[model samples]
Target: MSNIPFTLHTQNSAAINVSLLYAASSKYEGEWSGTPHSHPYAEFFYVLRGEIDFQAEGEPYSLHEDDLIVINPDVNHTERPRGPGTVEYVSFGVEGLCMDPADSGMWSSCSLFHCRQSRSEVRFFLRLLLAEFENNLPNYEQLCCHAFESLLVFLKRAHPQELAVTAPKRTARECSAVKRYIDANFRQPISLDHLAEVSQLNKYYLAHAFREYIGLSPINYLNSRRVEEARVLLRDTSHSISEIAGIVGFSSQSYFAQVFQKAVGESPGEYRKRLRRGRQEKQE
Candidate 1:
């Protein structure tokens, strides 16, 4: 029998600053043996095939094909193979991005997330990422990174249960309309009145329909979108917090800070610092 315990392939060839790692194994049928471990960087695992049993903080679960698992930084966890089939997965270790567990809006408390992608579009992307990992083509790292981002976006939209919201059914067009409005006006001082006007529905009906269709109230959705935009700007640019606050439509930096803290569990400045440190550590 081959003695290779586990294979971890690390890639640093991306034009961007993020690090990508791919790991796969088949010898997981024995007693659980992975040491309880954690990473300072966020880890996203996409299960390509087979089953793997996972335990996070004493809660146990099993994952199958097309399932995405997120183990945030510093979370204690362990995993082992579940059956005789091969267990293949790709793990992304991002450096410059800081993900707030709270911002996910699915879990009230911090915990590991196991998300299944039933949508064909999402499953297609997952398969494409897996193929790239297995083949290691030229420029595959960049392709994999883009596919990974798309996968996350898909998961965020489709996996409401994971985000602690009831799943709702609405055509993609309707959902897009709501999301587009929020994205376009989140930085401005927007209100339900403005949103209902934009969506062309009465205030009460719009509020109810939006909640039933999109899974969040208008105000809550706007806040989340603005915070997400601010996070990206804080990480990617040298803009000051006050400048970003204005650009994202918050009238005051203090208000922005308060909302950000409540949603992200950290102030904008602190979040930016954490992302910078994460990148620097990866470089070293």
Candidate 2:
């Protein structure tokens, strides 16, 4: 046998960095349609079971199991179950990456990688990533992030030219706007969907980013704001608990009392009475 020497050299610089915004699994049954919305970062969907009818920019495509779709940024799309059966899929919001499916004339702004022929790796990575989230063990964030990067690497290997790395822009301005809106409208009915529409962000991503920056989820922050106002009313004004609850935008006094008790140490009435007792003792 002849001896042969082979050495491979590669650059040490880093490439293909992606930030996982959010990853989730969903199962839909019967007739359900999502509102058409667009985001600033690329979104991905992998059909695990059943069929999904996806509409992007008014173009409809029937996606079956093992079908992978990568939607570029700012492309309005919606999905629903194709038929009577249930449609289950895993979705990911990825920042710092974009897809250019120029070779496929049929898919204009998005690329569809048909994984029917070879789907084992895709299935494995997604299943493992979701399990990490479901289990939420120690250092699950790091594990999930690595799993996400592995899945992205697989996509890049499958279609080298279609995927490219781009850093995700910071969303400080948008997050600030959401905070301002919540501060102004805390006395009115608010929901996550409304917040998503206001910020033009996917709700999941918005919630994640808001929590990271503000230390609380959007709805939680809103409730905190309401509770803050309720405390002021409880201390300064002699309004009834029910009246104060209505003034702070709570639908029912019981819910307001429950939330107030959770945030503070005691119920609203108890808090007010304690304050009154302290004030009377000071006067005496």
lDDT per residue, candidate 2, 29-132, as tens digits? Answer: 78786787767667889999998888865568889999999876666788888779888899877665555542332213466887765589888888877787
Which residue pairs clash within candidate 2?
A: none
- Give each model's whole-structure lDDT: 0.62, 0.76
Cα displacement (angstroms), candidate 2, residue 7, comes to: 27
Q: Report each candidate's C-alpha RMSD, comma-separated, in the order given.
A: 18.8, 19.5
For model 2, the local distance difference test gives: 0.76
- Candidate 2 global TM-score: 0.49
- TM-score of every model versus the real structure: 0.41, 0.49
Candidate 2 local Cα displacement, residue 208, angstroms? 34
TM match of model 1 to true structure:
0.41
Candidate 1 Cα RMSD after full superposition onto the native fold (Å): 18.8
